[model samples]
Target: MPYKAGHPCFESGCAKIIPHGQKYCDEHKKMHPEEIRNSSTRGYSSRWRRESKIFLKAHPLCAICEKNGRYTKATVVDHIKPHRGDQELFWDRDNWQALCKPCHDRKTWTEDKCPVYHY
Candidate 1:
């Protein structure tokens, strides 16, 4: 017989009932816990790191340091708006700034304890 939309079970011999419009019974199509969980937990892969590295290499001097007359090498990217929950600011290149090691360290320390990044 053809599959029925309103049928409770796929077939009389099936032990478990199937949902309307489904071809297979529950036991036949049920997904494992690991399969379902792993699919959702997938994260960003290596491509993102490669792009960021390329950007840093092309512009190697700290923007802040360069502007302030210090020529420290920029090794880290700083997000004007942090990537905690503000998703809109994630890839905003205009909001990115390069910082030297000591300056970056001081900025992070100030951010952890103070209200703003000081020059």
Candidate 2:
């Protein structure tokens, strides 16, 4: 059989080869434990869905759109400040706002800077 292919280590400037279906090799994994946990464990759950639905009902209009006078309907409950797996902040109503998917995506891309781009 041919040899299995692998990718370079995710660590910046590291050339260590690691198997596929992983974000980092064993060596660099320790430095990024935060990336190990899946999204549900990070805070989102069934309860979050229910609460977000209720929140959307109560705040039907998108906060960002309302500010811009567009009156678009809200389809997502966005945390004004990132909770970053903090349960208290995750459940904090004061830190939540209703947003359309587009505005939420834009805010997340601009503010959170997740999936940091290479170029």
Candidate 3:
């Protein structure tokens, strides 16, 4: 379906109409880079995965949910603080939390001011 004439592009200051089912216009889409990176390249390497598996095994329930008296199974090993690409912080097990998908997504959205799109 074609976009309505007045629908603005998602990119800031661009007045172009967004195509149906797309967040951005053709121009903005081309300008934007890939939103997410592969786990291996984004520092979630094989080692990280292995460690995360071990951590998750030990912490099978979501920490936040557990604190709230809920028992949700954990699927993500998240850093308590923003790592900001810092190697030390990224690998710090003490600063980690076991989170279910919803809990992790909510926390990340709060921290980053953006939604976690799993494309």
Q: Write the per-residue lDDT of candidate 2 for residues 25-71, one digit (tens) a residue.
A: 88888766567777688778899999999999999999999999899
Model 3 misplacement above 4 A: 1-10, 15-37, 114-119
Which scores higher on TM-score, 1 or 2? Answer: 2
Best by lDDT: 2
Give Cα distance to truth, residue 25, candidate 2, Å.
Answer: 2.6
The TM-score ranking, best first, is 2, 3, 1
Candidate topping TM-score: 2
How high is the CA lDDT of each candidate model?
Answer: 0.60, 0.87, 0.80
Report the lDDT tens digits of candidate 3 across residue range 1-119. 86465578888898887655566777767554344344566588889989999999999999999999999999999999866566788898999999999999999888855433332
Which residue pairs show collisions in model 3?
none
Question: Given candidate 3, what's the lDDT at residue 104?
Answer: 96
Residue pairs in clash, model 1: none
| Rank order (by lDDT, best first) | 2, 3, 1
lDDT of 1 by residue, 4-74 (tens): 55545444476565557565555644432222233223322365456557768878999878988889888
Estimate candidate 2's alpha-carbon lDDT, on a 0 to 1 scale. 0.87
TM-score of each: 0.50, 0.76, 0.67
Error of 3 at 66 (Å): 0.8
TM-score of 3: 0.67
What is every candidate's alpha-carbon RMSD to the true fold?
17.1, 5.1, 5.9
